[model samples]
Target chain A: MTRIAVDAMSGDHGAPVAVEAVMASLRAHPDLEIIVVGDADALNKEIARHRKADVGDRLTVQHAAEVVGMCESPARSLRQKKDSSMRVSINLVQQGSASACVSAGNTGALMATARFVLKTLAGIDRPAIVSPIPSRRGHTLMLDLGANAECTPEQLFQFAVMGAVLAEAVHSVDSPRVGLLNIGAEEMKGNVQIQQAGKLIGDSELNYIGFVEGDDIYIGDVDVVVCDGFVGNVALKTSEGLGKLIAQFLREEFSRNALTRTAALFAMPVLRAFRRRVDPRQYNGATFIGLQGTVIKSHGDADAVAFASAIDVARMEVEQQVPERIRTLLAHSLGE
Target chain B: MTRIAVDAMSGDHGAPVAVEAVMASLRAHPDLEIIVVGDADALNKEIARHRKADVGDRLTVQHAAEVVGMCESPARSLRQKKDSSMRVSINLVQQGSASACVSAGNTGALMATARFVLKTLAGIDRPAIVSPIPSRRGHTLMLDLGANAECTPEQLFQFAVMGAVLAEAVHSVDSPRVGLLNIGAEEMKGNVQIQQAGKLIGDSELNYIGFVEGDDIYIGDVDVVVCDGFVGNVALKTSEGLGKLIAQFLREEFSRNALTRTAALFAMPVLRAFRRRVDPRQYNGATFIGLQGTVIKSHGDADAVAFASAIDVARMEVEQQVPERIRTLLAHSLGE
Candidate 1:
């Protein structure tokens, strides 16, 4: 049984959403265990209000005094708020009481606290935030999603290895195809850093393809894409913005007049299928890779459904021993 | 009457598409004159096939013996192919025979030829590819779209002024809201370059917002977004790929079964509206800003209708004196 710790008070909806997600998750996975870290009083009320008589003792509550606000500085908040739920959740894993941790709070704070508590892997300089986005194939894992704004070429090479490990262990691909994100596909296109990173990745044992542009990320043919945090973050956010805009435009267009309204009835099924394909909740969890232990960060505005998905991701990460495999891959590839 | 030079031999479909676009554009704008540059034998044949009896002598043909392939190195191609259609179109603009030049050839070659033929404005160090993207507020103009891989804070500042000039002259916004694209919206979030750029923008006379993330580009609230060519190119290509992927998914979903297929009949209007809303053709022409003369770069795969759109863009750009306005704005803002 894998035990995962939850930051009960960190998400936009706070204890109620986390508590409901935990209940739903526990009822679904019989052998799964979870530690809910938050204010004991608030969490108990939520758990008591929701947990049924048939509920198991697999779900437990851990008390945390303070809460980290969504906008707080990662370093300042983690230092001042010693007993914040976000910190406590990472502490549970560091103490070996939980196999993995999930947080839907301030991303910067979570990364800072997780790195401070768990530290990076032996050979890894800094941990990368790897998130799965829906693509034409199944999903593509994009790394350095606002973790380190600037990275060295060697760091990008490390990201390729770490991303490959997760793709293999979690996604079960035989040999994942990794791509380096650049302005253009041509080898001579990007700056010195990307060219250097390309050489390092090519020399490695990983199945490194040449450079890929932004659109290649959604084509979904490749399994992993490596980029610096700055570019990765921009691409991710731009996609979200575009998706929202398209949805808004569709909504406005479908409601323009009576003829369109009638057409909307017939378009419902296909629209629903389209929704499922591009659903933001389905792509909620972002795995923080290169750390000693597993940490998954969910969208701050995630509802119970999305938070539950993040929990599922954490469970999968721990069950698959993704971090251990990454360590092994790094040792095998980089270490002489 | 404004005369525009067309690179007739450059696009995917070559002279046929260009000739058709010229006829269509002439029908749309009675006062526009075009000088089609390519092999005299091929262009005259195409013009004879499509040119109607009522067509005025406003249409003319120029002969060029050589052509630049799409993938050839920009410098090498420009250096070797002196009489190429791409080069001759810019030469017409340089010789003051045409007000603007439009090309659908290789982007690198186009930029190289345009830069070599028409040097940048006095205060500008490099020319930026400024293009309008469909957004909530009609459109948002993004600059440095693969023009310069790297940009200094000052160059970004100049892009702001140039983009603002286009927004005011071409987009017709009196006071355009300009934003600096960054990983995060926070004041201290981005790297040193962005931070310094933010400082310069905030201090400048232009209407500057603090910071905008990738998603904000599609939000349509801001008028102009400035970034280095590398990030801008990635964002632009990613949007294009996602747009295509979503369209493909919609096609597959709407035709999955008999029921969905039947619903497609009713949903046709809405889908068409969606298409019109996100039509890639409407956003084709990329204005080469900061140059001494006007130049428009159309997509290589542009169809007749899309090529006509590029023609319309050239007409608007030349009539509005976009380059002159950019030069004036630069001299006013930074020249002193």
Candidate 2:
């Protein structure tokens, strides 16, 4: 039985949502166990509610004296809230009490806490935030979503290797094709940073495809796309925004008049199907890779189902020993 | 009467589409005059087709012996293709033969030619690529789509002023709210460069709205969004890719089965309305700001209607003397 620690005091709604997700996931997956780490009183009440709802003893509670606020500074919060839920949850993984940890907390705080507690894998200087985005050919794994804002050419090369390893370890791409995110597909395009990174990756023995443009991320043939944190964050956020805008446009246009509304009624199935395929909620889970242990970050506002998705990703990552695989690959590639 | 030059020999299909857009825009606007620049014999044939369509003689042709190929290096092409249609069109703008020029040609070549021919406005160093993206509040103007890969804090400030002026001049936002694009909205967040830039803009006389994340670009509360070329290019390209992916998903979903096809029949009106609002073609024009003369770059794959939108944007910029306004404002802002 694999147990993953959950940061119950994280996110907007906090304990109830994460606790409920644990109960729901436990019911669905008999092999899974979740240790809820938060205020004992608050988590107990949510646990009681799940118990009354017929959830089993697979859900357990662990006390956390403090909770990191969303607006708190990551470094200061780390010092002030030593036993915060986020810190405690990551500590469980550090102590080998849990296979992994999932948190929907302040990203900066979470990254700082996890890094300090778990330490980094050998040969890995800093970890990366890797997530899957749905595309034409299936999923394209993108890394450095908001980890290190400025990455050297060597660091970007490391991210490519780690992303490819993650894709191969979990997503099962035999020779995961990697690409450098750039302004244009041509060799001479992009700034000095990207141009240098592209050259390094192109020389590497890994399945390093040359330059890939922003459009290539969704074009979906490539397996892994690596970028610096700034560019990655912008690309990810813009995609999320555009997705919502498109959905809103469809809803508004469908309700324009009685004729369209009536058609919307009949067309609900097709529209729903379309929405389901492209729904952002289904793509909620993001992994903090290159760390010593698995740490999954769910959206701060994720509901039970989305939280469950994050837990599922945690289970997958832990089972595959993604971090260990990355460490091995990095050591081999860097000859350390 | 305002005269605009069109690069008829550019893009995938070449002269015919640009020529047709001129005919359409001419019929729509009584005061607009368009000069189509391309190979004389080929352009004359396209003009003849429009003539047969009963479009007016407001359309004229200028013969050019050469064309800059899409894949040619901007610098090498600038030297070799002096008589290329792209060069000829911008030359017209420089000589006061046309108020502005619109091209659906190779972007690098267009920007290089425009810079070489029109030169930079006083107090401005490098030009930026600014374009309008439809948003919840109507439209938001975003700058540095892929102009300069890396921008200093000072350069970003310059872009902010120019974008604010454009918003005030063309978009008619009296106190246009400007936002600096970053990974997070908080002041303490982002790298040193953005942090420094944020402080500068906040202290400026313009209506700076602090920091905005990637998602905020689509939310559209800010009238203008400023970013470095690298990040902006990624955001723009990612947005474009996601849009195509969503559209493709909808088409595939709607045509999945017989039941979905019937639903599609009833939902056609709403779907069409939704398509129109988010259509890339509807938002075709991209202005090369910081230049002494107005230069618009149309999408390489733009159709007649899309090309017409670019023409409209060019007309607006030329009529408002956007370049002169930016020059004066830059000079004033710099105390030069």
Candidate 3:
């Protein structure tokens, strides 16, 4: 049986929606056990909506007195709100009561609590926030989504290695091809950090494909892309913005005239397929890798379906023993 | 009469296309005079292709011995390629032979030669690359596109001032709103540099709107978006890539079947309008602001139409006296 800890008090929607999603997911997977960490009264009220009698055997509630605000500093929250639900969920992973933890709370708080409670994996300096990027060919995993704002060349090289291992383990790709995100394809095109990372990647044993520009992110030319959190966050948000703008423009275009409305009926199938291909929910969760245990972050606005998909991703990561495989791989090449 | 220096040998298509575009632009505006800078031999051959014989009176070729390669380092080229067309173009502007210099060669080389030849205006440490970004709403001018890689908070503040003055001169907007590009909209959201820049922008005399995120670039909420060259380059390229990807996807979607093809035929007018609105050529030419003289960079792949548009933009910048206005604005703000 797989046990997962859900941070019931976190997210924009708070514990109600998170509890409902977990219950729905539980209905689909009968063997799974969920540990809800949050205020006892709120958890009981939400669980009662699903009828505690139906899920009482599969659901367990852990009480926490404090909550971490979305705007609170991560370090301050970690030091002050020791009994917060975010901290409690991470503690479950550290105590080995859960295989993984899932949260939609303050990203910085979760990262800090995870690092302090669960600890970083051996030989890992800073963990990366890795996400599955939907591409033209298929899906590609990218790292440093929002974990480290600044990174050294060695840190980026480590992210490439860790991201490659995660992609191979979760997606079952053999020797995942890695690419360094840069302004240009030339080895000498980027800043001092990218230049140094390029040299390190070229000298490493991983299957490092040469540099890739931002345009290549969706081109599906490579399996993994590595960069610092600052560039990665901007890139991720830019892509999201573009997707929204394009969708909005198409919708407006389709509604502009009677002929377009009639033509939209004929093109609904293709449009629907295109929409699914770029749907944010289809690629919902981002894995917080390089920690001692698995932690997945679902989008704050994610529905039941998206949260369930995140749970599925976490299960795969744990089942594959990705951390051990990465340890072995890095030991051989990185001399850990 | 407005005089412009054109680097006839620059751009991907070379001299003939550039000459053709310049001639076409001249025909549209009878008051404009153009000095075509290139090898005298190549200029005469391309010049003969134009059927209008009297165009010779409005245009003349200046001899230059060398052309800079697109990949050549800007600093090295400035030191070695003294007789290059780019250098000669800047020399013409400095010597008051022309109001502005427009080139389609290597961006770094053009900027470096312009700065070295014309020097920065008083109280300006580094020049910034400014471009007019086409948003959902009309348009907004963004600065530091690729001029300075690393910037201090003070330099960013200066960019805001220069950008506002240029927008006022060219777009005829009074007190254009300036925004700092950051990951979030909150006051305390960005890195140390952004935090300091935010304070400076608030304290400065310009209409400094607080922090703006990546998504805001397309929303057209603010008139001027400011950031370091590294972030600006990433944002610009990412947007360019998305534009191309959307165009390709639209083409594929339209060609999926005969029914959709007929629908595409009916939607052509609306689609074409959308394309025109987002077309990069419509906003060609980025001005290297803050130098003593104006230098604009057209795209490397600029065709006749795009090159002509760049020339028009150059004309607008020159006629509005953007450089002199920026100098006055900065000198007043800094009390220098």
Q: Rate the local accuracy (lDDT) of all candidates.
A: 0.89, 0.87, 0.82
Per-residue C-alpha lDDT of model 3 across residues A274-297, encoded as one tens digit per residue = 666567786877898999999988
Q: Which ten residues in a row have the lowest lDDT in candidate 1 chain A?
A: A182-191
List iRMS (one decimal) for every candidate.
Answer: 2.3, 2.4, 3.5
Which segments of model 1 are wrong by more than 4 Å? Answer: A53-55, A185-190, B185-190
Is candidate 1 or 3 superior in DockQ? 1
lDDT of 3: 0.82
TM-scores, all candidates, are 0.98, 0.96, 0.92
Evaluated at residue A308, the lDDT of candidate 1 is: 92
Error of 1 at B132 (Å): 0.7
Q: Is the docking of candidate 2 incorrect, acceptable, medium or high quality?
A: medium
Task: Place model 1 in a CAPRI quality band.
Answer: medium
List RMSD in Å for every model shown. Answer: 1.5, 2.0, 2.9
lDDT of 1 by residue, B1-336 (tens): 999999999968899998999999998888899999999999989988974655588898999998889888888887899999999999999999999999999888999889999999888898999999888878899998888888899999989999999999988998899999987622234478888988888887789976788888888889999999988998999898888888888899999999999999898888898888889898889999998899999999999999999999999999998888877777767636
Q: How accurate is candidate 2 locally (lDDT)?
A: 0.87
